[model samples]
Target: MNRFDAIIIGAGPAGLTTALVLAQAGKEVVVLERGEYPGSKNMFGGVLYSKGLHELIPHFWDKAPVERPVARWVISALDKEASFSLDYKNARYTEAPYNAFTVLRSKFDSWYARQAEAAGATLLTETIVEDFIYDQQRVVGVKTGREDGELYADVVVAADGVNSLAARKGVIKKDLSPDDVSLGVKEILAMPAESINRAFSLTGNEGAAYTFVGAATQGIPGGGFIYTNKDKLSIGIVVKLSSLSKTGRRPEDLLEDFKQHPMIWPLIKEGEIREYLAHLIPEGGQTSSKSLYKGGLLATGDAGGFTLSTGFRVEGANLAIMSGMAAAETIKRSSRSRDFSEKGLSIYPDLLRQYGVLADMEKFRHAPNFLKNPRLYQSYPELVCQISNALFSVEPGPKKGIGEMVKEARKGKQLSRFEIIKDIYAGWRGLA
Candidate 1:
């Protein structure tokens, strides 16, 4: 058995960051990964938020394989034949501390893992951590799929993704429910650079991201996204697991339907689909997982249910990096004191709270359910898109003002004014 000051499971962004931070602090750290390489099996929607990430590796964009810096964000209200988009851009974002950027997880994770290695941490690929090596009730180490299998550590940071078995070993009290989890399926489509630039109205390293809600998922409690990469497009759908399964719809079928939407069809007209991937993520916040830390162990990234999927945005990678950094800082402090127990590991969870990560998730806990409304996921988008189409169709209808048309559209939906007010009130309260 090999011994180390700390052992981290999963070499994705979270684990790698944690290892790098702790190792740089002069604590011995080893990261065990199940993939052939760090990012070989990873996938994401492609946007990286700046706030949490920049705190981990200052000026990361200088060395990272970032595809494009996002300059504009658009949310499209969609239907089968039409769509409406609300876009926002700022010149201030063109400079440092930029809002967000696009990334290919496979490329990004490998780069991040290498950073950890450069910081004096050992990274083990193709090594799966099977279970915790427990002493009494405290987790003191792990058993691996490697030869001779066992390794000891003072603490463990389980930065594995959403369906983490590390958290399943009785540390956390409850199992996640279908309603709290989302199944996301994505495809990366390659298109010629010129074609993409012309299609998206781009000049240089600027990117566009669009989120489609309503009539896009065939009435599922979720939506679709199209993220522009340098030479490809990352497009996909994320739906509540329970809702999809109950409706008896395959994610691929849903993707096909999404792609067929009149507003979506023209956007990807001739691009060739290059890759397909799916992952389960935590949609509902605190109620989604039972534990974030336990005896001699700390959980970071998706393992702690940190992904926040508010209807308009998804912020997982940023949160993962932040949590990993916090865990490492906690471990560093614990190492100095030589107290690696449940009470000691409790510091990691406390640090997460102090970092406002847990607090933000708690504050937005209502956002996910408020998003579950079928009207918001279906009829509303159609309403908005139809309104935009009507306003721009260049056909002869009664020349009504935008205000009159908006009133009529609201009344036409057989929706009560009270309900609209309530939804607006709830959405604002949950997400604002």
Candidate 2:
């Protein structure tokens, strides 16, 4: 029976961060990863925000396997043949303390786990945590698949991603609902750095992140994204699982359609597919599981439902890091009193709030439901493209004003003034 001060399940960002913090504080910690290596099963849409990660590893970009600093952000609305985009680029974003950087999880997570290992945290790869070892009503440790593999810990941190086995074992959180999750399918397209820079108008290590709605997903209640890496492009489509099922549309097919789009094809033309990955993303927002801790156990990251999606951006890694820090702090506080019970670990939520994990989730609590409105994904994007086409076309004898173009765009679209106003109000309340 091996024993430690704390045991963290999964070797992803959250679990590794927890291990790193605990190990740095001179506390005995072990991280169990079920994959062949730390990041063998992990995948994410490229961008990793700097603030939360910096708190864990100061100036991490100096040595971390970061692809590029994202200098341009584009949100494009695509109709069948037309597109309208809001593009913003800032030179400062390419400098130190960058806003965010494109990263490949397989490379980044392995590096992060090494940081924890360097800090003296034991990492056990290809180790599956089958179930929680319980002491009556409280969790005491985890039971692995190995012979005599019941490892004990004062506290167990479940960072096992969205489909957390520990969380599902009737303790930390409930099973995720299909309606609350999205299926994200991505591909890494290998290309020359020069080709990437030329295509995206980037310089040096500067990159671009583009998000598309409307025809990108074929009006599915979701969107598509592309992130520029050093010499590869990460492209994918994330669609609500429930909506996808209703349409009987395969995510792979949707991704292929996105790549074939006239607007997207040119950028990724001649690129070779390097890798394909898929994962489930939580979009439950405010309605997501809030129960982060229980007796002798604490859940962090996707296991705790800490991901945030607010239409404009989807954040997970940073929130995962923040939640991991909060979990480590809670365990440290509990150690003072030697109380790992639910009440002792009650401070986890407050710590999460202080870290802005809960605060941001709360701020956009209405966003999930707000985003579910079909009009935003389908009607609104088409309307924007139509309006753009009307404004840009020069062959017309009589040019229409912006207001007239908008009216004309809505005329055959079945959208009424009242419905548009209602959507505007909903957007303000849900996302603002």
Candidate 3:
């Protein structure tokens, strides 16, 4: 068995990042990945936050296999007929130090792995770590899936995503509830570049993204998203597991309902669905889920459930990259001290908090419940679309007063004046 200073499992953002930072710091690190290729088994809804990422790999936008630079961002309250939208744009993100970009995981993770390899870290793909190899109390290395495949490392960083083996046993005793999980299904719709630009109302490499609240989830606790790629559009819906289990509605059915929405149908018309993907994402995070570190062991990324959600805004990949780097940094510091134990691993959590990931999640703790608001998914969006249709109707006899139409629409949705104010207060406060 070959020994290393550190071993990182799962070659995703977190693992690759751990290797990069450790390798750069001159640690002999090995990243063990199960997939034949780095990103072969990875999938996402398709948006990258370049904020924390830039800190790891400076000038990352230059060679990353990103799809588009985002320009317009939208948030919508959907109804049966029409939807209400809030749109924003800033050309400030168009140049260097860009705000965000869209990427396919297959390409992005592969490119990231190469960066880690360039830093001299060994990347072992088509390899799965079956379990931990412990020395009485601490994990010394891993038992792999391949024959005669046992490797040793002084320390191990678990970056194996939501279902991490590092979390096995009593280490992280949290089991995900259906309410805490969301199933997301996305399709790659291919279209002519001209059509995509005209439909999304963008020119150049600029892209658009949206989060849909109402009919898209068919009364489930989730939102629909659409991101414009170069000649493709990544469109999907994320519905809560509890909602799906109770309603017994299949993801495919929910996808159709979303695509058939009056608001979404027009934009995707004449496009061909090129690829389809369905995956579950943990939305509740790992606040009470697990212990982040033990003697000679640490966990990062999805393994730690570091995803942040505020009804619409998401921050998973950014946290993954950061956590991975932090883990590697922890290893580097511990190496100099010649200590790798529970006390040494304490630095991992301190670093995470110091970098503000913990504080950020704590600040937005109300997001999960806000997303479960039945009114938003069941009533609000449809009512807004109706109000728009009624206010703009061209009647032959007479036009109703805008105020009167709005009241009628509100009444039709079973919303009271008090409820409207209450909903706004709750939503805004929770998001705050």
| Over 4 Å off, model 1 | 287-290, 393-414
Q: Against the true structure, candidate 1 has what lDDT?
A: 0.82
TM-scores, one per candidate:
0.94, 0.98, 0.94
Instruction: Tell me the spans in candidate 2 whose CA falls farther than 4 Å from its real position.
Output: 287-290
Candidate 2 local distance difference test against the native: 0.91
Over 1-432, each residue of candidate 1 has an lDDT whose tens digit, in order, gives: 399999999988788889989988887899999999988877778898888768778888899998878887888777777778888876666578888998899989999999999999999999988888889988899999988989899998888888776656656545578987888999999987677777777767778788888766877888898888889999999888998989988999999889887778788876799999999887766633237777788888888778887877788988888889888988888888888877776677667767767777888888877888878877677678767866876766568888776776776676677887888998898798
Order the candidates by lDDT, highest first — what do you get? 2, 3, 1
Tens digit of per-residue lDDT, candidate 2, span 132-227: 999988999999998999999999999999888865675766677789799999999999999999988888889999999999999899899999
- Name the candidate, 1 or 3, with the larger TM-score value: 1
Worst 10 residues of 1 by lDDT: 283-292
Backbone clashes for every candidate come to: 0, 0, 6
lDDT on C-alpha atoms for all candidate structures? 0.82, 0.91, 0.84
TM-score of 1: 0.94
Q: Please name the candidate that would achieve the greatest lDDT relative to the true structure.
A: 2
